[model samples]
Target: MDADFLLIRKMKQGEDKAFDLFVHKYYKEILTYCNYHCPNKEYAEDLTQETFVRFFAKLSDFHYRGKTKNYLYTISGNLCRDFYKKVKEIPVEAMELTEKTEPMEHQMTDVVNKLTLEWALKQLPDEFHEVLILYYFQELKLKEIADALKISLPLVKYRLKQARKQLERLLGEEEIYESGSKTCEL
Candidate 1:
């Protein structure tokens, strides 16, 4: 069996160490997912913690049929949706620059493009935005995204295709696509 399965079993048996190990393994990933959905970092951290709390509450009932990581994502996604319902504001996050040997001009252009893309993504409907975030930002496979979102694989593909088209229109085909090439790996 996988480590997750073993951890879940130990957790069900009231092993605190197993729970700690499980949280340590997934906290960063879940926090990142929440950060993408929540505008405020503190609120995002709260959502991440709440996700873990809810998961732990439901642990006894949770069958180990699905990957624990996907289940955490599912919980976090739902929490994010609920959070937006109350706040109803989408804000762009500041881009962080890493040290690179590239020319300053190139770096500036990249930052501008990223900010523009983030703005365009915010303009998209939540359904489309979530799919793109899962597929690209979270780097989940299509199948994994479908599982986390509790949707069929075909529907995931459709959303991804439509999201790409919408982003292209919002960013302008030329700006988002470089000589018909995708800006980021597809």
Candidate 2:
């Protein structure tokens, strides 16, 4: 039997410890996903809580057809979409850049690259941005992302390809603006 199946079984039997274990296992990941969608930390926290709440509420109906974590992501993604509809905000939290001992000049370059990537991601449509976040930031497999987002596998591939192209264009534009010279070779 799958571990998640056992966990769900225990949870369904009203075992508080099982529920706690489930929450502890996935809370940080879900919160990180929500943070990518929502700029406000507080709101992201709320969305994370709500994702668990909805999952627990539907626990009885949830069959272990896929990974539990993916389901949580789906719930959080829906909640984030609803949040965007109400708030009309496009703010996104940037993924953390790697920390390493480097010279000041290299550090500054890393910061600029991070900012430029963040800006480019924000410029992408929600569909494209979500795929990039799931694939790159959250490190989800392509099939996992398709299952989580309830999208077709081919569609996911298409979106990822298009998103990369768009990001390249956006980042190229930023480089030109910053350096006052075209740096990207088309």
Candidate 3:
């Protein structure tokens, strides 16, 4: 049985400690997911909170129909939709994204490469970007990616193939099948 099943049982049985453990375990991961999708820190945090609030309300009704990760993403995705509905603002653009500071390297080239890659990732479509980030940045296996994204494994592969091609084309690279660690100048 999945850990979420245990967590669900504890939650249904009104175990406060188990609920705290569940939040501690998944809060960062869910936040990372929300940030990736929404990109606005305040909005993402709000969505994360809403997701858990809904999750708690629906906890006992939770079915193991999908992976727990995907369930969370589904909640997050819906919140993103609702957020846009309420705010009615222009979506965050990649060019507008500022890089979080890192240690200054001797060469500026690496920094540029990293920033360029981040921009490229932000520019990708949400579905493709989610799959790529989960697979590479989050270091999840393909199966895990399928679980997290709630897509079939074959669909995940197809999206990964398409995303890699798109990234390669956007980065103007002749080689299309490289790892995420490879620096793209664009």
The candidate maximizing TM-score is: 1
In the predicted model 2, the residue pairs found to clash are none
The local distance difference test score of each candidate is 0.83, 0.82, 0.73
- In candidate 2, where is summed lDDT lowest over 10 consecutive residues? 177-186
All candidates: TM-score: 0.81, 0.77, 0.71
RMSD of every prediction = 4.2, 6.6, 4.7
What value of lDDT does candidate 1 attain over all alpha carbons? 0.83
lDDT of 1 by residue, 1-186 (tens): 789999999999999999999999999989988977865678889999999999999999999985789889989999988998898764444334636989999988876775677688889988899998887778788999998888999999999999988887887755533422224432
Could you tell me how far off, in angstroms, the CA of residue 54 lies in candidate 1 after the best superposition? Answer: 0.5
For candidate 2, report its TM-score. 0.77
Give the poorly placed runs of model 2, Cα more than 4 Å off: 90-116, 173-186
Mind giving the per-residue lDDT tens digits that candidate 2 earns over 94-163? 3344468888789779767656666677799999999988887687889999988889999999999898
TM-score head-to-head 2 vs 3, winner: 2
Give the Å shift of residue 160 in candidate 3.
0.3
lDDT of 3 by residue, 84-148 (tens): 57875545353234454754562355546655665777678878887786776555788888876
> What residue pairs are clashing in model 1?
none
Superior candidate under lDDT, 1 versus 3: 1
